[model samples]
Target: MTRSRTAGGGGPVALTPSERAERGKAARSSVRRSEQARFEPGPDRPDPVAILLEQEAARVPELVPIRRGRMLESPFRFYRGAAAVMAHDLGTAPHTGLEVQLCGDAHLLNFGLFASPERSLVFDVNDFDETHPGPFEWDVKRLAASLAAAGRDNGFDAAERTAVVLDAVSAYRLRMQGFSGMRVLDVWYARDDSADLRAMAAQGGGAMLARADKVFAKARSRDHLRAFSKLTHRVGGRLRIAPDPPLVVPLTELLDGGGPTDLDTGLRRLVDTYAQSLAPELRALVQRFRVVDMARKVVGVGSVGTRCWIFLLLGRDDSDPLLLQAKEAGPSVLAPYTAPSAYANQGQRVVAGQRLMQAAGDIFLGWERLTGLDGRERDFYVRQLLDWKGSATTEGMAPQGMRLLARVCGRSLARAHARSGDPIAIASYLGSADTFDRAIADFAESYADQNERDFAALADAARTGRVTTAEG
Candidate 1:
């Protein structure tokens, strides 16, 4: 495969299968590169925190209610704060050659439970819209920092917070080591079902078992039928979305701004592209359904300004409905660090990365280019956005619950990395859990401080009217 370089002053390069194999082999051989890079904090370069804030400030006018709603939520506030710091640190950090497909924002909150293709609930890294190949340490650092931040939110003392983060890092290290010992097929087959997780928690002989059971219950409660029941309402034999401010609103209202009638036309065209992306069996299954209600919905903090749509499709019966979400795609946060995607469309990058990371993704996953109301061409990917998805509550989890959650995240992350990484070499580099745990613990504390500084800056900007908060 030949790809044109969009960054740097480089020309097109041909990457043959053999050359690709060689690159993977080289990456495997150099897996311990992260260990070689001393983990000292780097001198600040251009503050990515400030840069991100400036970007957000530009979008604030367009993202009034949704962004304000997210900022008002404490956990969401902390997440935004942490993201600013991570982006800052990453902008300044020295290179560790060990790179893999990263969940650019791999915070503890991002890991969750979703249904696998087999209709069994499995714990996994649930979001990958920002996926890109980059230094593996970035993901580890972000995850560790999130643990500390979460602990702080739960009112844990510094010592307790350290212990929680250390335990999580230890689990991540040990799981990676375990994967190194597995055969390729075994690693590929490896999955963490609710039963397996509960059993592991029981074996840990702590307060983890009860917490694991609670997590299992939450995961099980998020099936397709349950999700549909919660989001849809029946009105005279028709299925319709219950309108909610910011999060959900009718399509007619969204198109009423006199922005463009083509918005609806674009949506219809995108749905056809989505249908074509599905596997034959799934496509056939979906073809039986008729589109009933559609809405424009806003979701997530960082993704507030992007275009997102939800469609309610009803089968022969009103009770049989499926909900799908289509989200716009832009350049990845990791784009600066890794090679630019060969595909011109960012949505294609997202779809490809999801397929690579998930064993069985929504068959309807796909992308298309559409001209928006502003006459800007945008890329979008469509999927069964929330069929059976749920996450452990991080707000007030007991210390033991945090530990169990950490292990689940660790195991899931290992499985994700193992899919595209050289697990054997990665395990070898990790060695024992001790050093890895300590390193991440140190990074987490330092990064948390960075987050605080950035949060204060944001507050200052809001006060000074450089960036207007909803309160302003």
Candidate 2:
């Protein structure tokens, strides 16, 4: 693979196997720094519960109506409310030296199915914008909390919900133990496809096989061309994006009617950065497409305020359209506890982490800094916005299916951690699944309570006119 030079004349240096191993060791050493407490004294602010309420007040406008409606309910209201609290706990949590590319926000909802390079559906952690090197416990805690909350929403009793949370953690711990027994390359080469996963689930008493089958079917039905066709329509002779207010908007609204808009310039710069980020062959493959239009598209609850743009690119013909997403980068919630990244650019952090975690990534993955209309410089990484993606719906899943889904998420997370972390050390720390699972279950239940209090606080703020709620 041809190595592309950085924007200035200094090109990236290629590393030999030994050199790469040395770098990995150095990275691991940096992560070891996180095991010790480095809690900085800052201004005393709201408690974790209060902080969560404030965040919810800010996030309320961005949530879809369906999610918003759920928030109106008690426990569901609490889960949305307690995100910041969970973040706070994670920020101050105890750590082990073993570190991988951590998914800073490892909520249950974040796991999903996506197409690999081989066109097979695989289940894995789907979001990495908040990824950083930190204590693995933080991710485990967050995932557990999300599962507990999700279980509540699914109408499971408290004990049953606790069991589900424990099972998820146990799966992660056991999988990490298994990974510790494998050769480094063997662990790295491991990939899970739908068929294998379904088989595994089937072996586990047909736990999640049916739901997995449904989600896999839905995801495999979606591909690049199908996605583009669904999102684009012909307006006269020109291809234009169909607008869905608050969620999706046309590019014209985001740009001035000049030769090229601010978005266009930002996108071009981002593409150039992305080209440098890719391995040589992938970069060359991406060069064939010419960017035509871009649109600002809103996605996910936590990511609503952040700028996310979908670029429409043209290949040899109009029929060959590719959609890429460039989402703004911000400080990782884990930054307060984790070692500071060597890379200054948050987008670069995201792009680097995604490449390290995924077997094969989108060719267009890149990052650039853009000055918004308000003169604030925002960093962003670009990738295929939604190419053959789908996830198991927690709401509709049966208890057994949910348990299996949690296990799949846990195992996949462990695999990712194993690839980038010292599996033997991590496995040792995790020891038995029982203790870790119980710990996570405890944390999840406590966090869910915190979320409720926070949600109420947000509701109170809205009721008292501290924040405004958008009407559907």
lDDT (Cα) of model 2: 0.69
lDDT of each: 0.68, 0.69
Give candidate 2's TM-score. Answer: 0.83
Query: Against the hidden reference, what TM-scores do the models get?
Result: 0.86, 0.83
Residue 402 displacement (Å), model 1: 0.7
Candidate 2 on 49-137: residue-level lDDT in tens?
A: 34534444433245433333345455654464345555666565445545678887788777888877777777788788688887677
Number of backbone-clashing residue pairs for each candidate, in the order shown? 0, 3
Question: TM-score: which candidate is best?
Answer: 1
Worst 10 residues of 2 by lDDT: 33-42
**Which RMSD values do the candidates have, in order?**
5.2, 7.0
Per-residue CA lDDT of candidate 1, range 283-390, in tens?
788788777777877777667766788888878787777788888888776776567876688888888777766655666677777877336788888888675677
